[model samples]
Target: MISFVIKKGTNSNEMRENNSSLITANLLDWYKKEGRDLPWRETSDPYKIWISEIILQQTRVAQGREYYFRFIEKFPDLESLAMAEEDEVLKLWQGLGYYTRARNLHAAAKAVMDRFNGIFPSTYSDIITLRGVGEYTAAAIASIAFNEPHAVVDGNVFRVISRLFGITLSIHSSEGKKTIKKIARSLLYTEEPGIYNQAVMDFGALICTPTQPKCVECVLQDWCTAFAENRVGELPINDRKIALRNRYFHYFHILQNNSTFLQKRNGSDIWKNLFEFPLIETPLPNDFSQLVKTDFFGELFGGITLFSVDHKLAIKHRLTHQLIHTHFYQMIIPEEIPFNPPKNIFKIENEMLSDYPVSRLTHKYLETI
Candidate 1:
């Protein structure tokens, strides 16, 4: 397979011919002076770039930088990441709230080994085919790593472009997405697409901020439709308000002797491939009194009688599109595995459970107890 040819010269002027002449020049000039000195930005390695992109997506750059350095030091190459144990990976990603990103990083590493013989794919299409590589991520990798002249229309770009072009379409709307994508692609300067893409993203994040953008300092202030029309706050329109789905998770901290019943998640959802206590999720909150009466419950707590009910802890967590309200019921059980909780919930030593990648709510409870 042919690899992307690395650029041998620095030429920002020629690339500006395709985009809004004013915006391109100003954006690149501002980036050269004010762009954050990110470790990933310093290298062309797709592996490092991919890791930084995933981390930054879920966290602010300041907070993500430390983790980025730590993670890179850990699994520096794709082979190391592929060979690392899942528990070790999760432990490295412990404080990072979105555990799915860590899981995908590991999965994609293995995928690269099995599919591409361990080398990271170089083209936009190949990168997009990897796990967790969406259009935005793919565009970033392709342009940043291989200088593919594709545009990355993330939130920052959405805000900048909507206001610059005076577009009134809701950014979340299909029509809005179509309009912005077309314009973004057209604006992509193919000659130095990598630098051009980075400049626009950096310009949007730093200058075209969500609130009180510095229009006087912006290069294309005169051409900006929203600014000219005195409606900078309303250009990047969005209509969708996420409806939080309330779920009642009753985690039976079922103890049989000194052991507890736990299981790792198996599906393609948040908390997937993580471990958790035996959980009973009801649409609405479950009545604790009735739940305790089930005969199967006896199998879990055979030796120890129910002491006082521990204080109930309620926690809320959000996923891509789901909100989880989890309630923990901590119980004391003996050392033996109970027969009642099926194989779906595996029996494990209480002391060793820390190695499992449990949910944040569960992690909180475990930390306290």
Candidate 2:
């Protein structure tokens, strides 16, 4: 039999009213038997836990595992990561799509060093002050690292709680959030919150998954309201749907001798600070012939009269809110022509291209040629 102590809310009456104690106990039991043996779970260090959590955001566990290992090997602690440069950090986080997370991690590491005297904050209040540390992440770190009884309400928790309670409110609504969070708080087994948090998260991940939940074998199935009502698939209602906007990019990979021009992306846009070939963005997709005739195209290569061009097949890259249709063009400029590119763009040796961090879209194009 598993024990549960309600950290918040009224008392045993509230526990019995919601059957939270039983739910929590069964969840912990399920976790003990079926929980994943992830590398992050083996340690109690807040720094490492923070790393694992940030990496796992917008990244699959399988892919993030290797990145985590490599990242830890390079910058093991807050001090190490704080001292390191942004470029080196970005380079290490090359293939990770959400570059902003890496940047925030780097910034947060420096913050930990400056604000907390190189020590990771123990309390949720202090931890949330760090960059990229939201309520979910802060709760995770505070509870898992310092044994603070802060219930983590991520997508997994949302799904599991909604199904277990057979919630019908839209998850996007404030009422839904309050209801789910309240239930989560009530169900948090406060005796060993670190273990309990991990258990609930593991139970959600392993048994009550998003798409194809193993309800038949789930320990919580008997207690699950959605299962009892035969509405498991429809309980967790989410009304938000992303409307994707399309943009077209024509990247010019101009080569003069063994060197090529690569520019660092700037501004508050996608792929900021990452290196890429000179790009001309258009409202709609355009072919090379149409692209060459554009005003922006002429401004870039107005003086360069003698050049050979070879266009590659257009590639479509999809992101959360945007769809990018990218076209890569390889141009060979003559050695004698005074080719002056944009001030932001600098010439780099073709052999040294791998040194700088680039977007995955740019990397894929590089791999082809």
Candidate 3:
């Protein structure tokens, strides 16, 4: 039997340490039998592992699996990725939602070629220097690929650690992350940090899930403080709530002589570098009559004669922190060229629009026409 000496005002750090060891042992043992046979787990190739990690961010395992294979089939290796154009990379990642990840992945591939001689950096410090590689991603790659003893503290790890230890701190807070990182490092099985990290993540995703956890089958249930205290649902706290801002978009699909106009988004705003129709953003949703009265609309179609204007189609696209209500208007103009077009605006054959990488909203709109 384990016993603890109660010193007045002293913390129970020693007892906690002992519990962590037990948790680690039981978790790893359970993992050997129950861990999912994921494709990334079967290889130690840092490039493959890095691709899986990037694809898995904000993406479900089932969805990410298909994209992983598609990406691998397309790029094949770091060298292939580095030589490919950014547009080609984004085209492959068209349906992946987060285009920025694809962009950063392409950028990092080139960086690897230029800085590390086309080989993935092996150390934690070197891996973290890659574009869009944060602490969680760097730790994951370093530990899993290089067998480094860095403990990964991603969302899964955070949930598992918080519930097992009954930590009520907000996971979004800096102090909470630091505390969890400390606990994760202590519990990491240094002998096989790769397997251990994957095991913990699988345990959290399969057993200690966000909702409707399978507590009865969990290996660490006996020692899980939250389970014993009946606080499994309440332990892992995230008090930060995202306030979504609303934006209105009016997209004009101008067609003349079997050709349409599209412009590439160029700014720090969302969907940067993606192609879209001529856009008129307004403070609020406006009808065609009101939209045409605006000065921007006059400048856009000043010298052109419209043959017909189709009824507007509206789409509501939701992002993490923004709600976009887009109104798409189709306009057919005369074939004769009259005035100079807006900057970045160019004409493309209607059939060739599919060649461009467009936002999800634009893709959805294209499917209709």
Best by TM-score: 2
* Model 2 misplaced stretches (Cα beyond 4 Å): 1-18
| Candidates ranked by lDDT | 3, 2, 1
Q: Residue 334 in model 2: shift from native, Å?
A: 1.9
Per-residue CA lDDT of model 2 for 1-369, tens digit only, reads 534443322234555455677888888887888888999999999999999999987888889999999999999989999999999999999998989999999999998888889999999999999889899889889999998999999888999988887778988899999989998998898878888888887777778888889989988766677887788889699999989999999999999999999999989999888999999999987888898798877778865679999986489998889999999999999888888876787999999999999999999999899
Q: Write the per-residue lDDT of candidate 3 for residues 1-369, one digit (tens) a residue.
A: 325432222127986877888779989998999999899888899999999999988788998999999999999899999999999998888877888899999999999999999989999999999998999889889999999999888888899888888888899989899899899999999999988989988898899999888999888876777888788878699898899999999999988888899999988899889999999999987888898888888788874654589866899999889999998989888767664467678999999999999998998998897
TM-score of each model, paired residue for residue:
0.84, 0.95, 0.94
Instruction: Pick out the ten consecutive residues of candidate 2 with the lowest summed lDDT.
Output: 2-11
Clashing pairs in 2: none
lDDT of 1 by residue, 103-124 (tens): 8899999999999999999999
User: What ranking of all candidate models by TM-score puts the best one first?
Assistant: 2, 3, 1
Clashing pairs in 3: none
RMSD of 1: 7.0
Better candidate number, 2 or 3, judged by TM-score: 2
